[model samples]
Target chain A: MIEVKDLHFAYGSNPHDTLRGLTFHIDDGEVFGFLGPSGAGKSTTQKILIGILNRYRGTVSVNGLNLQNLNSDFYESIGVAFETPNLYTKFTALENLEFFAQFYGSGTRDPMQLLTAVGLEEDAHTRVRNFSKGMKVRLNFCRSLLNNPKLIFLDEPTAGLDPVNLRKLEALILKEKSRGSTICITTHDMHVADTLCDRVAFIVDGEIRLIDSPRELKLQHGERFLDLEYRDGTSLICTSISMDKLGTNEIFQKILYKYHIETIHSREASLEDVFVKTTGRSLQ
Target chain B: MRLLAALKQDILFQFRHGFYYVYAVLTVLYIITLRLLPETLVYPTLTIILFTDICTLGFTFIGAIVLLERGQNLTESLFVTPLRLHEYLLAKILSFLLLSFASAFFVMLGASVGGHDRMWFVYGAIFSALIYTLFGLVFAARARHVNDYFVKSLGIGLAISLPILAYLRLFDTPLFYVFPTRATLILLDVLDHDYALSEKLFSVASLFIWFLVLSGWVYQRFDKYVRHPA
Candidate 1:
């Protein structure tokens, strides 16, 4: 649904380029997560895709239409939830949604339905100034979906959410995917990407270090070794073995034939581990 | 059509604040205060005083509204939407004008029954208030902070009104007549059924010119400041 080719962007007339010929694509109904720490150009890339920060030196097309030639109608086909909760505090949650809903000339969703989906139906009449950060984020999330956008740009949608609410929001993103919406999410939370994304891209310093399925990347970078643990009398005995030749090895045969094995497992790498190893930086 | 919906929502949202109540109370207080003033102190009709109050207060209201929107970052939010910048700006101006006119009209209605001409006061108040509001929007757009608008507008108001007020109280001069206050005074005279015909015509022309010039400035500045989403 979205394609970016050799995308490069720089702020103003500055000599330094923020994006250095980066390229990526997101297929239809795919949840693609751009994982990176802060100041790693995660937001700058999202801003370019959403058409906020202009003056780019690349080609970006959303839903088969070139971004350079698209107008406000392009906004009609997409939803955007900015990292910051930029809303009108003077208006009620419902009023904020309804006001923005009017900006689209066609296919506007019902504001009440959106509120209900985000679990804000009960507080629809209360002014947004009285809302908490999480509540405002939910409202902002609902606002993005008001146009029934085919593609959604979510920048740290789960940042201010608690675990329970985070799960609820994650489920909502999954629901949107089930309804055939392509999502481009940028977040530093590895768990979210691991659990929700169809594919994840690790970005560092405005460049894509790696992009692949979570399971595949983990398996590829993982150590091919096994650890066995068994209780021997009053003391616990641990042993390590190479998985490269485990079947024909006498030690592995002895452990299976002579010892009472309590647990045996291969050393598996996690998404966070692979992210750190590839980027040489932590997700913090 | 979509722009109109956004505008209607903005107007409704603005009216739901406590500040609207404060504006209503101030209008009532101004009417009662005018009634208490002795005859010698009251040069023009009470309706003219009420109209002038609207013109003064409208400037402050628009400045405050724009500053509030800027402070909350709602202006940038609107910019990202499909709503045109001109439509959003016009909606704000229209809402301010309508709200101020309603308050001024209620006061003038009561005052007109006593001695003032209703039509002249309504027209003059609406005209001058709109001109002052357009002037306020220019400053609001340029102001970096909300409090800065308060200080700058107060400075501008004083710089424009202080000399005119001093001259009117001290000595009459042809130069003083060129000021907005002097033109407003002529407007009041016309509203109170006492101005010469030529002065009344000149007041209308001068007030219209002020409205035109300030409105022109708003359009020019608005175009330069607003960057629509790509």
Candidate 2:
């Protein structure tokens, strides 16, 4: 769905390129994540892909068309939800959707239906200026779906939302994925990345440090042992057992038969841990 | 059809932003002031009003509107859709031009001004507003906020008025024909009844040429800002 080769971009006043020789591709109908901290070029990469920022030196093709050569019709097939949740503040929620809905060709989703999907049906007539931050974020998501887009770009999609609303948005995104839509998200939220992304690229300082499925990353970076906690007398005993050939090991059999096991958990690293270990930088 | 929707949205946005309300009050105040003036004073005063206030209002108003959009990060949102850069520019110019022309018309009608000369207010408003609105786009491109835009726009604001010196003939502007204000002055000088035919032809031609040339410049500048913001 998208491809980038040696993409480099620098603001006019800046002396250094914000994106420096990065390369990656997202497959069709895949949920891809661009994971990075602030100023790590994730947003810049998304902007370049969406044709919002065109002065980059690179070969970027989206849906088989060069990013630099993309016409407005290219946008007709894609949707973008900005990190800042931009809407016409003076216009009501319904008005905002109706206004943007007109920009697309036929096959666009109904504005009211989209609002209802985000649980915003009651506030459809409320001016955006009166919305809380979470409401605005939901409305921003609604606008992205107005085009019934085949490829979607979402930046910080779950920011400023309570767990219920956040889950609602994530479900909506998954539903879009079920419809065979390509999804690319740039975010610092690890759970969203771990659960929603089929693959993730960990970027730092304008470079991709690692790219892999979250599960693979965790296993590759995690310790190859099990954390065994058992009861001995009235006290808890903790011990580590190697993951390899544990069933035939005598100590494991002795611990399994002699002591009551309280808990036995494999020492698998979390996605955040793998990110920090691989990238040498925190997601903060 | 898309462009028309955008135009309507822009007009509605502008109206909701209190632009129409502000102009309504200004129009009423100017009308009352023009009616109280002597007949000899009406046209000359109207000429100055069209040249300075109504025609140049786009230069002032567009800055605020664009700055506000940038504040909300709405420019980024708008550009990501199917709207082309030129379409956005045209919508902005046409929307504010409508406001400028309407305000000029109502003020003239309320003032009881008539004759073919009064139609110059309509033409002058259009030509002058287009020129200033493009200037507003150029200035707003790099501005961080409304206050920052005002601070940066003052220089060009004063620069465009340079032709007023030549208009009064206090100093000869050998390059007056090149100035946008030069065309604006010639168009707005309907009250003088002394503008030569060549000058009238020059004003219309200069405005048309300026619109074409300045449009390309503004499009590239705005495109640059959107692509790699300063």
Which clashing pairs does model 2 show? none
> Model 1: per-residue lDDT, tens digit, A1-284?
78999988887667888887889999999999999999888988988887666578889987788877766656767888888887888789988998898888777889998888878899999999999999999998998888888889898999888888888899999999999999999999988898889999899888898899988888898888899997766667898899987899998898788778899988879999999999999989
Report, for every candidate in turn, its global Cα lDDT versus the true structure.
0.77, 0.87
Give the distance in Å from residue A85's predicted Cα in candidate 1 to where it truly belongs: 2.2
TM-score versus the correct structure, for each prediction: 0.81, 0.94
- Enumerate the candidates' DockQ scores in order: 0.37, 0.64
**TM-score, predicted candidate 2 vs. hidden true structure:** 0.94
Error of 2 at B126 (Å): 1.4
Show the colliding residue pairs in model 1.
none
Tens-place lDDT digits, model 2, residues B1-230: 77888899889988999999998998898899899999888877777777777446778899988888788888888887888888888999999889888888888789977666655535666878898899898889888898899899988888877888876668865697788888888788765566777877788888888888889988988888853463
lDDT for residue A127 in candidate 2, whole number 0-100: 99
Where is model 1 more than 4 Å wrong at Cα? A1-23, A55-61, A64-70, A90-92, A110-113, A201-213, A227-234, A237-268, B39-56, B113-123, B142-144, B151-154, B157-189, B193-230
* Number of clashes recorded per candidate: 0, 0
Q: What residue runs in model 2 are displaced by over 4 Å at the alpha carbon? A: A230-233, A245-262, B118-121, B166-174, B227-230
The most accurate candidate by DockQ is 2
